[model samples]
Target: MSSNKITLKKIAEIAGVHRSTVDKVIHNRPGVSDAVREKILRILKEKDYQPNFIGRALRNQENRKTIAVVSSRVNSEPYLHQGIQQAVQEVGVFGYDVEYYIFDIEQIDQQIEMLYTLAHQKINGIILQALYDARIPGVVSDLAECGIPVVLLNFDHPGCTDALCYIGQDSRKAGRTAAHLAKAFLHGSGRIAVINGYYEKILNIYDRCSGFTAYLAEIAPAVEIAEIVDSSENAHDLYHAAVDLLRRQQIDCIYATSSGTEGIGKAIGELGLQDRTHIICHDLYPEILRMLREGMVWATLSQDLEKQGYLAFQYLVYYLLKGIDPPSKKILIEVDIRLKENMPET
Candidate 1:
């Protein structure tokens, strides 16, 4: 049969399966038996059946182009808002509709549910800040195999082969930068406490801690880590953790590798350590900037989050509009160290 004359329904009839089953096999979606899928593929090859995906995409574009932006809760993260707004502005000019979906990273079930929703949404593409979960690899793999592209924003699943590309900071390097600052501030001999999020599940948090520890060992041999606290992204929890450490050990400096610096700062101030101990944290959030100006936080590492979101959107647009893949699978955003003297312009 001629390629143009052969339809998916005809193929399904010849194979004695439902039309949806044939579609699932053709698109590499799940639920089809391996043997039946092989048979359908062999028959398609023999009949020279080729799908007109470009034409389909053009039609879909005309109807409406949808992209989903999934990330941690935005009400608490101003930087996330900046990134999403940048993406919304750029994609809107091209007539692509953008949708924002917020998830609590601490709630693994909610994160997984939102991912499943995006999977079924049949979106043109996805910009995701995925929380670490064991089930995430399979979901991401299935999405890519089914021809849906995903661009990771800020965080990525390094072991998942299906993640098309990543646009974010090199988290490990940011950690090392924090170590350098700590070494300089303390004259290379002090007790440093490291604060992190859920390290076991979050790769970025783990990487940052590893990077900071490795560098501190290399350059500041006299300095020792007082304690490594896992705060689980909660400011109040971190405050209690910090207060506990302050009572037990002499912490000369604190390095916050993940979120919840506000609580940590509060703990330091209550203990009257803010004037003596230097605190280093990540992000340039309003609270963080306030801490910087008020001399509560000595330094911070800023990842150009808005630019990361902007690039992720541009990559999806190019792929959908011009059939072009990203130039490289790994893209690095610039990581800047912010001090009171060099704070980002408001």
Candidate 2:
């Protein structure tokens, strides 16, 4: 454990405290005052002390356990894949073999079968995002009954007792933020349209849309929200939907609760309405990146997708091995507003 070489006595000496005092603070006992706790923490940080994660892994029977990251098909959205990949890579050093399984959305039955197969294969953990099924609680219970830890990402399964923790942004808050942006950009009231990605059944979409609607109804009473429109999770459909809505309603604001911002940008530009109406989108994808740079989209509610995936697994590891609850419950990634001048190039 060379990497974790420093002893509590050494840290205590530097912190000007007795070994037992330091130990009490380290274990979060109430005897240590907050001020002393801060000082000791400062010393630990300054010394760059890192625990022997490898040694910790070797001691646990589940060391080098397999973690499966399951999601819908990668499709055209490379950002989703990138974020999940980066998360797994970041956690790989801790002795978790992270493998991604992209399932066909239409064949959910097959997907369930595949997961069952993996369950028999000795999967230690699962990080799931993108598309939720109602039958999830049963499956999750099955895994928990077998001692596998489950971490739900992006979406929450209400009755799933097996979900150790859920780490992601608040869909409802993002919706409220979207509403505020819509009101400001529309200058009070204008016919606004919202576009959603294709969904057979999913929780994120429902939550996001519900939040958006609820917020707008409360804050901007006069703003007319257009009827529900679905774009088949395809960029082309998204572009056309934007065009149709803009042409018909002279839409003063547009909100897309999914990953179709790039297509939306194109439609807005082609109609020469980019300068007229305000556009707001979710997920700061490559397409959305450009619109934000061009002032086509006024603001974006970014959930830091990479961080979401990374933290989900990180929390799962904490619970599975350490026997501790995650530091946060219902983690809401901060909401960030991006404008034309402030948008960073991806």
Candidate 3:
């Protein structure tokens, strides 16, 4: 029979074995003897039989699989949401369901509580945007012990060795890239004011700042980081902080490692410092894009938030459905630098 027409029933009949026995051999499940298993395998190899995954999925619909995506409702949430939605559309037909949860970035206790809640609910797998808390490793380990796999998104914790993989941009490299741009814009000898959102709590932001400072120290020693401030990712707070900093000191540039670039732009525009002050920030929020167009911001570094979300969900689904692990422990997404000329059309 043609390979396309071959079925487990036909193979079982040819081998004179029960269909259940054939199924055991096909799925590598225990119960069949070695001799019968070898015979069924021979038939399968000779016929080039292929399992009907869609049919298997349909049959398994009574026990649907669930994947939970937990993240902070930060500036990049919309792009990440789009990616997860696309993955759901592709995987929904295969008896898979996704539950998405967004929490405030500052609420670490709430996030920890939600993790325990999902574990109690017996979620099949999880995709998480981990924070830089000491409690995370133990929580992830407990989830692994419960037979739930986790894929870390955006931020990674060094202690979470039990996680399946981490999928996000290399924040250190992005920070180094930002430093390079700052050096070029300033001719390697200017004072830059650094603004970060929750820098003490977020791992990626911390790494980005580390990289930025390290790179400048190695190559652009003349580029001085005059001040580093934490503005908590709030636009109004960021605005007030930026205004205070710019008014207090003659900053040649502003490098923001988190969201709320609008605040920095407003501070510069209102202070009439746009001609003198360069701004470098992360992500491609709508306001940032507009600022780039009007020359209120100089350059911004962006990563593929959608792709990060899509792969985190897709990898978890692959593991839950097929027992496959991601090929690498770290799946690093590329960082793209955006300027006004290269900005996407609105």
Instruction: Give each model's whole-structure lDDT.
Output: 0.79, 0.73, 0.85
What TM-score would each prediction reach against the true structure? 0.78, 0.78, 0.83
lDDT string, candidate 2, 20-99, tens digits: 98665544444878688768766665565554533343333244677887767634224555665665555554556667
Off by over 4 Å in 3: 1-57
Among the numbered candidates, top TM-score falls to 3
Runs of candidate 1 with Cα error greater than 4 angstroms are 1-62, 74-78
Q: Is candidate 1 or candidate 3 better by lDDT?
A: 3
lDDT by residue for model 1 (22-84), tens? 776655455888789768776676666763532332344357678887777622245755766
Error of 1 at 145 (Å): 1.8
Pairs with steric clashes in candidate 2: none
Q: Per-prediction count of colliding residue pairs? A: 0, 0, 0
Model 3 steric clash pairs: none
| Model 2: per-residue Cα lDDT at residue 334 | 85
Q: Where is the poorest 10-residue window by lDDT in model 1?
A: 51-60
lDDT of 3 by residue, 1-346 (tens): 5677987788889999889887866654557787886687667766767535444543454677888888887777778878877887666646677788888877888988999999999589999885688999899999999999999998889888999999999999999999999999899899998899889888788888999989987889998899998877888889999999999999999999998889888888899998998789998888999989998788999888899889988998999888999989999998899999898889
1 or 3, greater by TM-score? 3
